[model samples]
Target: MKSTVLTRRGALKCSLAWAGAAVWTHRAPRALGFTNANARPRVAAIGTGSRWCQRATGIDGPHGSAPSFVPFGDYVAVCDVDADRLGLAVDVVQEWTGKAPDAYGDYRRVIDRNDVDVVQISTPDHWHAKIAIEAMLAGKDVYCEKPMTLTIDEGRLMCEVCRKTGRVVQIGTQQRSDESFLTALAIIRDGRIGTIKKATCAIGGGPTSPVIPQVAAPKNLDWNQWLGPAPDAGYRYLAGDNGETQSWSRCHYEFRWWYEYSGGKLTDWGAHHVDIATWAMEKGATGPTLIEPLAVKHPVPFSAGFPTDDTQYNTATEFLIKATFADGMELEIRHDGDNGILFEGTEGRLFVNRGKVAGAAVDDLANRPLPDGALRAVYKGKEPTDHFRNFFDAVVDRSEPISDVHSHHRALTTCHLAGIAARLGRTIRWSPTAEKIVDDPQAQSFVSRAPRNGFETEV
Candidate 1:
């Protein structure tokens, strides 16, 4: 099989050619090397910051020690706006692969490389959609970090781009790969909880108040590039001025707190919890019809940190947002709860978090013998064997991976709406079908932000 070079024009042509085939049959493109065992998928990693580094750590090292990363794919390149982190990632890849993968400051260069087949993007919230869209348009399969887009429009656009390009995309909402979440969703779908009346999804507080004092960016870092697509804001080092210099901690992980850089906890952790909660409720492919921010009270004033009264952390720290679906079910998103989902139903209530799933009704349901043929119906089903493995499998099979763009967009829409309500401090009406707000112009404005001149997203 010949590996075709992915390009914007090429994507358009392929889309037109494959449209009928894609719809008539749910088959994915054949694997790049189904007939050849020696052929491995050529891959690369973009935004080798903290999270990306962590995910890469799981891949086999230079010796091919791990089962999955046993030289299954080559890490051909790495890109990052931060020079320091980029160099560090390149070193890791070189050390593991025994060859130096090309390095680039601009992601476009990496995407333009015809040799690369896959790109794992772990950039900031604002950069996710832009890079993912471009990568897909360029014909590279993408594994992008979650809360997949900065705005609802971007999420939808991403889905369209992938569909049009015939590219595989896996949103990095890892819980979708976790067993606990799978089991819970299976239980709920099986009707073990009777009927899900409502659910409470809670995430921890956002950054505390009182802005941290400004400090100079490290000499080794490219602060300007790190702020890609976002407006130029003053850079602040995580550690105190002249403090200990850490390699990966420079400009990446800490960026999650700033509104210009990220959606704070709303997109950070909320991406995980809200995604799972919505998936369990069978709302992963759709969104809420109504959303209103409940009354929230902040604590006494203090300086920057979690729960502080600082304006720097613009995301909500303490708040509740009620999302009502078209089906008349409600989901309460709050900053406080048992750190999991509470499914209140007609038969009994079920509480499930990462560590455990428990309910008075769960015991009765467990004790009763499952009816013939009923067990299979409740299993929300598993990915194609392995979670990450499924990504590679889908790449070869041309089938949609478990965590496709459409479902991710729905989950992200819910997360984005929660953030918008918190930012506007009011209830807002949403039209899921049209993907817009109704009547309230003030609320509508928060749907997307004006990107910095050169980095604006192209629809």
Candidate 2:
């Protein structure tokens, strides 16, 4: 594999973001094993299912999709368990790029290639950590979707591998890149809101899928590989182009509603809201010390953390989970209120969602203004740039992106703890230093699951 060198043209085009930083040297590009700077990073996308299509095609799928990787990297290959989706993605990429890219069914093959510079993992939540870790080990940078890990230990391992490999990995917690979120964090960090006492993240519940009869797996889909590390289950479908339906509680975006695939809304929207709240509170590298299930109501009965029923969506549909931090800050993560974070401070309160950032602190930003560089301070001294741009910049500069893996892991740990505590209907003690549920053996068990033999994600 030939390293791409940073071209003088590429340097000039992206020079603004690296104004004061030495982004290149006479032999730096060759030393860093990068290809010609004029050439974009070669991207191989894994998991070209519906979400991938939504990202690659800019079509709406779940949570209003965005065109991922297309704006920053060259699409060289696409991999998926579903042959149909893979073919469609190839067609879409070829149509857009005017050159058809290599397509593969197995992601392992895509990661093994030396020509690939970066890999995007938009697979189901259960598959996110494994693919990302493997990609990092293969010396490829990663742009992984949010809810970065299916379990607590997966996050720990992913962070470890990222450190070991020194790869520029960015988690897709894009709220960190949004201007409104930046404004909100700036206001909070500026102390207009006073000392933070509580943060409320009102992420909603998951939906229940209507029951459909079991059916044969679609010919284009590989049900076995799709299962991956998850327990094997029958093929299920919501609806077909011709109006046919099959039974399955989990698949596609609905995977967020199943415990086996995701941690329900606790992880789905929780990843976004909790991540923002944690950033504002400066708790990105540390998590709650105690997780108490204040009140939880689930769609199905849960014995311990496992759901007793598998017919319908089994994840918690509604609940209030409380986490107490080392600073005595109580975070209320619930299935009520608007989908956003509410910061309650000693002096004032601010509410921020995808739409707007409200309250006195945000308003005061206009009249009083944040200290110069407040926004850039939160962005790690760089100007607010596109999320993918940040990733590419870091790839070239060897700096950490705004949504680096360490902070994402901490926020994701909070979400995983909230889910575990809620499912067990018990208050669980945690040692943030140890990164484990304290004392309660049962609660500790949920920290990690036994991955199937070949699919185990280990550091």
Candidate number with greatest lDDT: 2
lDDT tens readout by residue for model 1, 1-459: 012223333543555335434422332232565335445667777777656664333323342112233245677788877677677777778877689889998777887676677788888788888888767765677888777888888887888877776888877766776666666666677777788889888777764534455578767667776777777877654344321223212245656656666776778877888777777788876789899878553433322312333334445568788999999888887887678778888777888777887877456656874455443333233332445676777777667777788987887788788777776667788998888988888777778777776665443
- Clashing residue pairs in candidate 2 (N, C-alpha, C atoms within 3 angstroms): 3-34, 3-35, 4-34, 4-35, 4-36, 5-35, 5-36, 5-37, 6-37, 7-37
Backbone clash count for every predicted candidate, in the order shown = 11, 10
Please, what is the TM-score per model? Answer: 0.84, 0.89
Model 1 spans > 4 angstroms off: 1-38, 54-71, 238-250, 297-311, 369-384
Q: Residues 267-340, candidate 2, lDDT per residue (tens digit)?
A: 99999999998888889878899998888888777786788877677788788998999889988899988888
C-alpha lDDT (0 to 100) for residue 370 of candidate 2: 86
lDDT for model 1 comes to 0.68
Q: Name the TM-score of candidate 1.
A: 0.84
What stretches of model 2 exceed 4 Å from their correct place? 1-38, 55-68, 238-249
